[model samples]
Target: MHMSVANVVIIFSIFSSAEPYSGQPHIVFFVVDDLGWNDVGYHNSYIKTPTIDMLAKSGVRLNNYYVASHCVPSRNMLISGRHVIDIGLQHGEIGYYPRGLPLDEFTIADKLKEIGYATHLIGKWHCGCYSNHSLPHNRGFDTFFGYLGSSDDHYTHIIMSNGLADLRLNDECVGYKYFGDYSTIMYANEAKNIIAQHDENKPLFLMLAFSAVHKPIQVPDVYMQYYKSTIHDNERRTYAGMASCVDEAIANITEALENKGMLKNSVIVLTTDNGGGSVGNNWPLRGRKNSHWEGGVRGVAFVYSDLLPMDVRGTENSELMHITDWFPTLVKLGGGNPCERKNLYGVDQWEMIRGMEPSARGEVLIALDTTRKASEEYRTGPFKYDKFDITTFAAIKMGKWKLLTGDSTYRNFWDMPDPEYGVIDDEDFDDTRMVRLYDLVDDPSERTDVSEERQDIVHEMLAKLDGYEKAAVPPQMQTKPRLDNHVLECMGPWID
Candidate 1:
């Protein structure tokens, strides 16, 4: 006997409910843009961020948390519970396609909805800019009030609600607007209003994605003046002001939760989409936002829950975790089933947070320029293998031992054959044919190359890197770029 689609859904629901905790938790995910690892006061920042500091003190701090090197991909991973490359999302600037989040593939929001929760996404819906497929309303959000694109004027914001461009400032209907005073403050007020109006009977899943501490560095005069006194650098001063706005917003949100008596039953998470830009510092790690270095991927994260003890509330966890983990972790916390059928990349970190699990153990694969549109690097454990040139793959580890196939400058030993293809595009230009290895443990800054003394380890790591690349998804087979017509049909007109 053949089963109908509804039958299949019923069976899936039954299977999902077989677990002990099948109820959904009230989730508030506060994703910040370009916020540095050390930008918050809890992370040693000079700027005053009392709200975030309070949250950190009341919750757990993830010391080794990681995210995509950029925004869109990181957000995709958080929602989809997959590596950015797995879903054909590898870049930040490119908008989402129709096939971005397949309807068949369940999302965090979808799962929560299934278990009886009200979903709302407020701010920066950058998943896609197409028609029905691009907006949060189509994805699983019961309500969506935010901009379809990335950055825009704060006051005259180009906002979309439930797939319609209905928001306007004054009498003119403009896409962009000056969001009088500070945008963060405005977003905070909006969030507070939404929370206050939420039905208390059902659980709420609110995604508070903020476009603060990002570029175009605009801030309200009040915050700017306050930051100028504490921060010396011009750029940092603006960053501090933007961060302060986010803090105040958080304060408003927490207060709303407290007043509604949902604070004890809710799980509130505050984290950055990725590492900071050149304007911010990711200290102890090298490199910035776009690179595969630690500085580019590491981010600031704090989780608050009333269930934990006060003494352990302000604790720190150094276990390595990534953005993908949030999906499974949230699901588990909400008493939902962790995916058991497929081999998902994320780990259920809820146990770790509750002191039930010892540490997070899983190898994370990061794809750099998976489309071969640009250069990229790969890191596993303490090892870093990169291909900056078409024929040179350099491997670096704890010590200073380095390896290279070609000469120091260009033609040192140019007779070597190109290295075998890893998980990247062969057509894309890469200088990995010449193998260069470095001991980076002592020389963490990677100032010198010592490949000459480490031929044995170099050969081993080359083989390992080759193995990893072979296991990774190739560029051509990645997500195909959708046609404009198809995009329009899927998402609707740019502004409907």
Candidate 2:
């Protein structure tokens, strides 16, 4: 059945105390799929995101934010506040039931609901997408009204693997569910409905993780036309349209909250799981979705609430943050201290959001993989140490000196020519992924290497990395049954 993609506003609001920062307010999170640091309007990208731009303009922009280099690890880390190895998925591949985030691990929803908040998940629940056993309904969420896997066919809602429907409401198995509904629009409507029907007496936590700009980049025609003129490549244009749709959905969600007078107390978290993928724009950064380069982990992030100190509003924050930080921060915001738990790897940064401290976070443990044998990375202050399985990609940085021990794929990573646009030469393909060093501050483009000139700094940075590599979590070798190509393609690559 085809349904008009209209803005369906459900007029129910969970009545809450209007007082500013009174206890817990509504929490709406929009974690878009594969949205790059340079994708949004606020980043001066051609892609139009008036809503996102306005949100950044009115909210706090996290200029130095980061996420995992890919989806599965990012989502797992974000939800569990545990590193992938501790959670049993070291690399960014693995999304299915049983293999998903372990039930034992506490989630943000679990924390919020414990403190009298009604939690709901209304989009891609990629953490796990199998039987009802591992779905959001079984998780901390009071309600789950989205897909079980990653990117579903936006219109058909088909998971495409096993060629079955992927859409769901609560827990019933999807069978061509919500036919003809543009997923971006459908997800937005669902979010608005949840906001309306929410019991305002308790705070609301809605995780609206949109499958925007993800692969199989399907978007509605009306949306596609909006970006055709600006985006040249047909594939990229389609991707841009999808991103545009997600931006619109965010705007509508905020509007619905505003209409109910819930915007005042709501703290809306806007971010993406990882860097841009296939058609995503990560220009000026090094690599794409899969690489651990800054392009993959640096995400477009922000937090907005009317209650946020007005002075900090629209201002850029330099405090380093990770996707996992939100888990503890939101818990603290809900009047509970998640960081108090010894098991959690996340720290509470609610004070940073309040502009009370310059940074509670000192270093970032981005990833430690034993997947393709053993490569890890840690970012402390201005320095980032990256040790990759491939000898050609090892790197360490301190201040302006970036020491790369392998052939750096800085330029050739995004070498694929778009379908609409013809091929381009590989600028970074110097035949060998060899040792190269570049000062990021001076050459944000990563075009030069000064490894020999800064041998002293390289030695110190390598020594610092020696400690991190030794302490890095080893990859877990647990494996589970595989699903159809369609299903596993989007989820994390499973390992047993």
Best by lDDT: 2
The TM-score between candidate 1 and the true structure equals 0.74
Please provide, for model 1 over 145-177, each residue's C-alpha lDDT reduced to its tens digit, 9 standing for 90 to 100.
665555655554532322223222212233334
**Steric overlap count per candidate:** 39, 16
**lDDT per model vs. reference:** 0.60, 0.69
RMSD of 1: 12.4
Alpha-carbon runs more than 4 Å astray in model 1? 1-24, 96-99, 158-181, 309-311, 340-342, 368-370, 373-468, 471-496
Estimated TM-score per prediction?
Answer: 0.74, 0.83
- Candidate topping TM-score: 2
In model 1, the worst 10-residue window by lDDT is: 413-422
lDDT by residue (298-375, candidate 2, tens digit) is 788998786788778779987777778888888887887685454676778878987988666655656655344322
| CA lDDT, candidate 2, residue 230 | 73
